[model samples]
Target: MKLGDVAKLLGGRLEGDKNFEIEGVSSVENPKPKTLVFCSSKRDVERVKDIKQVALVVHTPVQDANCVVVEDVKYAMAMFLRIFYPEEHPSGVSEKAYIGEEVIIGEGVYIAPFTYIGNKVVIGNHVKIYPFSYIGDQCLIGDETVIFSGVHIYPRCVIGKRVRIHSGAVIGADGFGYYIGKEGITKLHHIGSVVIEDDVEIGANTTIDRALIDRTIIGRGTKIDNLVMIGHNCKIGENNIFVSQVGLAGSVKTGKNVVLAGQVGVADHVSIGDNVQVVAKSGVANDLEANGTYGANLPSIEWSRWKRIYLYLLKLPELFKKGS
Candidate 1:
């Protein structure tokens, strides 16, 4: 597409050679000749003119270069390229797919080969189950949900519409619950279900545990990052963002719009309020109030002071070697 055509396609204003043809989209730092490069923010405006690409996408016009200015440069660039190089939407089920008995597969469902749909499972319309996916017994998958390759949904899991279950995600895993009995140490029973609400995107290899007698619920639009572990009976809130490797203990409750950054750990039975933002690697041992930010595992301090303090502490063992 030409630079002028790309700008029209992306709903952006072009301030360059309208006849310049753009083959693809790329980054400004490493621009491909025919490809259109994009700027990150206003700070990238300085380098926009020096970019080697034919077309550049930025928020405002840059001097001495062919550029397309848009409200959201990155989003506009993405939309522009996706239109030209569009990914194939998931379509029909293949003949080689292993569909189980009593499986109610809905219309427009894409069932890849070797996928195991268990008994009494109701798959919704436009759902895509990639190869090697395992949907366990009696599961209900909502419409437009995509279960990626190697995903394992255990029995009775209720997945909602437009939910994206990434590769290797294990839903409805057994809870880490145990109890002491008269005979010996016995394992507690897990008899609950996992209900994932609409527009939630579960990351790869993440495990969400089932409850003891109720439900482990994930609210709408909650985006969980890769390698996170959500323990049993946790009630996650709507539009929450849980970053990579976050660990939420059992019975934890979060209100709407909560944000947990990378590697944050929440203790069991803690109730976090709405709009809370936990920083990266935070160890949240207590409850967080609404709209509050707390729990930093890594303390921010002056590097020079920390180095001096560490150096003094390191000489303690040597100073007291053979004496007091």
Candidate 2:
């Protein structure tokens, strides 16, 4: 692809040789000949100033190197990758893949070797189930969804169109619900299923448990990161971004555009409103209102307040000795 063509595709202005060829994409800090790099911020622009050979994706046209100026660098990167680095999948169902009786397999569906589809399963068109995946009985996989290698989908789970479940992801597993009875600990069986809507991506090794009664719903366009644990009955809204190692207790509800950073933990039954941003390692114990940035220590205080308190605490021992 040419540098000028990339600008046209991104709907951005170009300020470079239109005939310059671009072979690959890389970060702004590192440039190779014919490589395309991205400059999302002013700092990135400064970093790109020293480079001369690469094609650049920028928020504004600069005179440094060949540039494609767009409104959003990250969004443009995603779009460019879709064109240049399309995903690869095997074609057709393998003979070693097992399909149970009465299963409905759609046209162009790719079932790799060692995949097991249980009874009455309905797989949609162009769906790719990689090798060693186990799709349980009565499961419904929507069109263009990709279940990567070693993914385990328990019975009756409904995965929507364009959903991507990465390798080692386990869906519809029993929730961690138990009772201490007179005899011993009694395991409560999960009777519900998981409903993942369109365009959601579940990261590698992330486990979403089934509810005790109703459904565990992951809303449309939500992206969950690797090793995140979502408990039973959690209702996650659309376009939410959950970073790695974030844990949500059972029955937690989150509104749209919520951002939970890495290692954030939410307690049971907590309701987080729309556009709430929780910083990394924050512990949320209660319900949070909309349009706020929360972070630090216990109870998830406002981000600014948390920073102030944390700084004050660092001086506490000095103040105590001076008082003595």
Candidate 3:
């Protein structure tokens, strides 16, 4: 593709030589010859100027190099990659797979080997389910969904369009609800379901618990990373990016585009507003408003500070001795 063609495809303004041909896409730091590079920041512009490349996908015009300016650099990158490597959809139940009675499978569905799909389930078009996947009864999966190996989805769960549930992700496991009893603790039954909205991608080993009385709702375009624990009755909103090992306690409500970094822990019943960025390892103990960014505290204190605090605290012994 040529530099002008890339600009036209991404709906951007090209302020460069249209004659240059790009063989492929590459990073700005180490540019491959005749490859498209991206410069989304002014700092990146200086970083990529001298490197040999065909053109740059940028928010501003490159000082002396070929430039294509777009409204959003990241969106343009996604679009360009989509165009560059177009996906070919696959279909049909595998010879090694097994299907239960009254099952409703849609067009262009690929059910792989050793998989079990239960009755009265509506699986939508272009759905690719890999090996050992188990979909329980009355589940509704929307179009273009992809279920990877060893995924166990419980009954009555609603998985929406373009949703990708990766390997070993257990959807709708029974929630941890117990009460004090005469003999011991008794388990409360979980009767509610999980509703995963459109364009949500769940990473491997993630477990979303079923609710005790109501539903657990994951909103649109939320990408949850591996090992995330989403408890019952939690409502997560649109386009949120949850990194690995983030744990949301029960009944937590979050607004749109909230970013939860790695190992972030949310307390129960708390409400977080839109565009709030929770940094890595931060413990969210209260509510957060929209567009808020918090920097977490460092655990390791300076040695002198620690010693001084320790010595100040040890004056209790001196006070006791003086009193005696």
Candidate 4:
């Protein structure tokens, strides 16, 4: 692609060398010759300052270099990446894939070998199921969805359009529910299902448990990071972002645009309001107010200092008593 063409596609302003050929897009740290590199900051610009062969998609024009200046550098970079390295939409179901009785597969669907589609599964158009994926009975997979290798979708789950579920993601898994009586501990059966709405991207190895009686809903445009565990009956709102290792206990509800950073844990039955942003490693035990940033976990320190702080905390009562 030409430099001017890239700028036109990305809706950016072309600064220099309209005819310069851009072979690909790369990072500023290790740029390839004749490729387009994104420079969001001055440091990034400085790193590739002397490299005149590569074109720059930057926030501002660099002197003596081919440049495509954009309002949002990251957005421009994403656009360039999509054009340079477009995702493959593989068509045709493999003969080795096991299609169970009465499966309704749409046109342009790609089911790789070793994939198991259970009875009465309705797969929408252009859907791609990679190798070793198990789509349970009566499941509904929408159009343009991509289920990567080793994904296990339990029976009756509904995956919406344009959803990307990465490898090892277990959808509609049984939630942790139990009852303790005089006799013994009894397991509670999860009869509900999981509904992942359109444009949601579930990261690799993330687990979304089924509800107890209804649907555990993952709203539209939500992005869940890898290694996250969402418990039963979680009604996650639209455009919510859950970072890696986030664990939400059963019945937790999050409003729209909520962001739970890495390793943030929410207790059972807690309700997080809209536009709330919880910092990394925070433990949310109660309901959070709307449009606020919250954090509870303390920052890390040296082990010796932590020990001293622990000792001081232990002696707090005595110190209070003496002061009184």
Candidate 5:
């Protein structure tokens, strides 16, 4: 692709070398010849200023370099990646795949070898189920959804259109529910399913548990990162972002556009309001109001300093008693 064509496709302003040939896309850290690199910061521009062979997609033009200046560099880079590396999956069902009785498969579907589609399942158009994936009985997978290798969808779960569930994701697994009876601990059987709405991307190895009696819902456009654990009956709202290793206890509810950072833990029955942003490693124990940023975890410091602070905290009770 030419530099001018890329700028036109990205709706960016071309600064120099309209005829420069961009054969690939690369990062600013490792510039490659004839590749287009995106520089969103001044430091990134400075790092690649001396490199003459690569074209740049930047917020501002660099002197004497072929540049395509865009308002949002990351979005432009995403578009470039989509164009350059379009995903290609096998189209037809493999002979080795196991299709059970009464399965309704749509046109243009791809089922790889060793994949198992259980009885009475409805798969939508252009859906791709990779090798070793298990679609349980009566599950409904919507159009253009891609279930990667080793993904296991439990029975009767409803997945919506354009959803991308990465490798090793386990949907509709039994929630951790138990009761302490007079005899001993008795396990409560989960009877409900999971509903993942449209355009949601579930990362690798993430698990969403099945509800005890009702649906555990993941709303539209939510992006959950890897190793996330969403407990049963979690009503996650639309466009929410849950970062890697976030753990939500059962029956927690989050409003739309909420952002839970990496390793944040939400207790059971807590309700977070719309547009709330919780920082990394925070523990959310109570309800959070809408449109606020919250954090409770302390930042890392020197070990000696942390010990001094810990000592002060330990002595606070004695100091308070003496003051009283």
Candidate 6:
């Protein structure tokens, strides 16, 4: 695609050579000729000034390079990649796949080899269940969803449309619930299910547990990264982003657009409000209010307070010695 055509498609203002033929998209740090890069900030614009590769810049226009000024560079990049580098899904059901009794598979679905579809399961149109995937009994997989290899969906779970569950992901597994009895500890059985709403993307090795009662719900457009653990009865709101290694204990509730960064741990029954941003390695023990950037230990403080608290902690030992 030509630079001018790309800019027109992205609704961006074209600068420099409009006729430059673009081959692929890449990052500015690794500038490749004929590839389109995205400059997300003014600093990125300055960094890509001397870069010869084509760029998609936000707000700022590069003087020397062939650039397209877009309102949102990241969104444009995602659109461009979707158009240019569309994923190739496997076609047709494999003969080696095992379909159990009363299974209802829709048209255009692909069931790969070694996949097991349990009894009374309903797989929607164009859904792809890859090799070694296990769809348990009474599960409902929505249209256009892709379940990658080694994925296990436990019985009665519901996966919504346009959802992408990557390899080794386990949905609706029994949560870590136990009861104290006179005899000893008794294992609490999970009687509920998991409901993953539309446009959600669950990464590899991520486990979403089944609730003790009702459902463990993942709201629409939520993106959960690899190795994340969402415990039983958690209610995750729409468009939330949980980074890798983030762990949510049982019954944790998050409002819309919440972001929990890498390694952030939320204790059981904690409530995270809408538009909240928890920084990396945060330990959230108490409830968080909306529209603030929080970080550090339990009862996550605002970013500014966290910085001050962190600085004061370094001088604590010296202050204690002087007082003694």
- Number of the predicted model whose lDDT against the real structure is largest: 5
Question: What would the per-residue lDDT of candidate 2 be over residues 1-324, giving only the tens digit for each residue?
Answer: 887788889998888888889889878777667888888887887876455788888887777578888889999999989988998887798999999999999989999999999999999999999999999999999999999999999999999999999999999999999999898999999999999999999999999999999999999999999999999999999999999999999999999999999999999999999999999999999999999999885666799998999999999999999999
- The Cα RMSD of model 1 versus the native structure comes to 4.8
Tell me the whole-model lDDT of each prediction, alpha carbons only.
0.89, 0.93, 0.90, 0.95, 0.96, 0.92
lDDT of predicted model 4:
0.95
Scored by lDDT, model 3 comes in at: 0.90
- Going through the candidates in order, what is the number of backbone clashes in each? 0, 0, 0, 0, 0, 0
Q: How close is candidate 3 to the true structure, as a TM-score?
A: 0.88
**Tens-digit per-residue lDDT, 1-324, candidate 4:** 788998899999999889999887777888889998889998999997456889988888888889988999998777767766789867899999999999999999999999999999999999999999999999999999999999999999999999999999999999999999997999999999999999999999999999999999999999999999999999999999999999999999999999999999999999999999999999999999999999988888999999999999999999999999
RMSD each, Å = 4.8, 4.9, 3.7, 1.3, 1.2, 4.7
What CA RMSD would candidate 6 show?
A: 4.7
User: Which residues of candidate 3, in runs, are more than 4 Å off?
Assistant: 299-324
Best by TM-score: 5
Clashes of 1: 0
Candidate 5: stretches off by over 4 Å: none
- What's the ranking of the predictions by TM-score, best on top? 5, 4, 2, 6, 3, 1
TM-score of each: 0.87, 0.90, 0.88, 0.96, 0.97, 0.89
| Clashing residue pairs in candidate 4 (N, C-alpha, C atoms within 3 angstroms) | none
Better of 2 and 3 by TM-score: 2
lDDT of 1 at 156: 96
lDDT of 6 by residue, 38-135 (tens): 87887776665457755555667766777888888889888988888899887798999999999998989999999999999999999999999999
In terms of TM-score, which candidate is stronger, 1 or 6? 6
| Residue 9 lDDT in candidate 6 | 93
How high is the lDDT of residue 184 in model 3?
95
Residue pairs in collision within model 2? none
- Best to worst by lDDT, what's the order? 5, 4, 2, 6, 3, 1
Clash pairs detected, candidate 5: none
Identify the superior model by lDDT, candidate 2 or candidate 5.
Answer: 5
lDDT-better candidate, 4 vs 6: 4
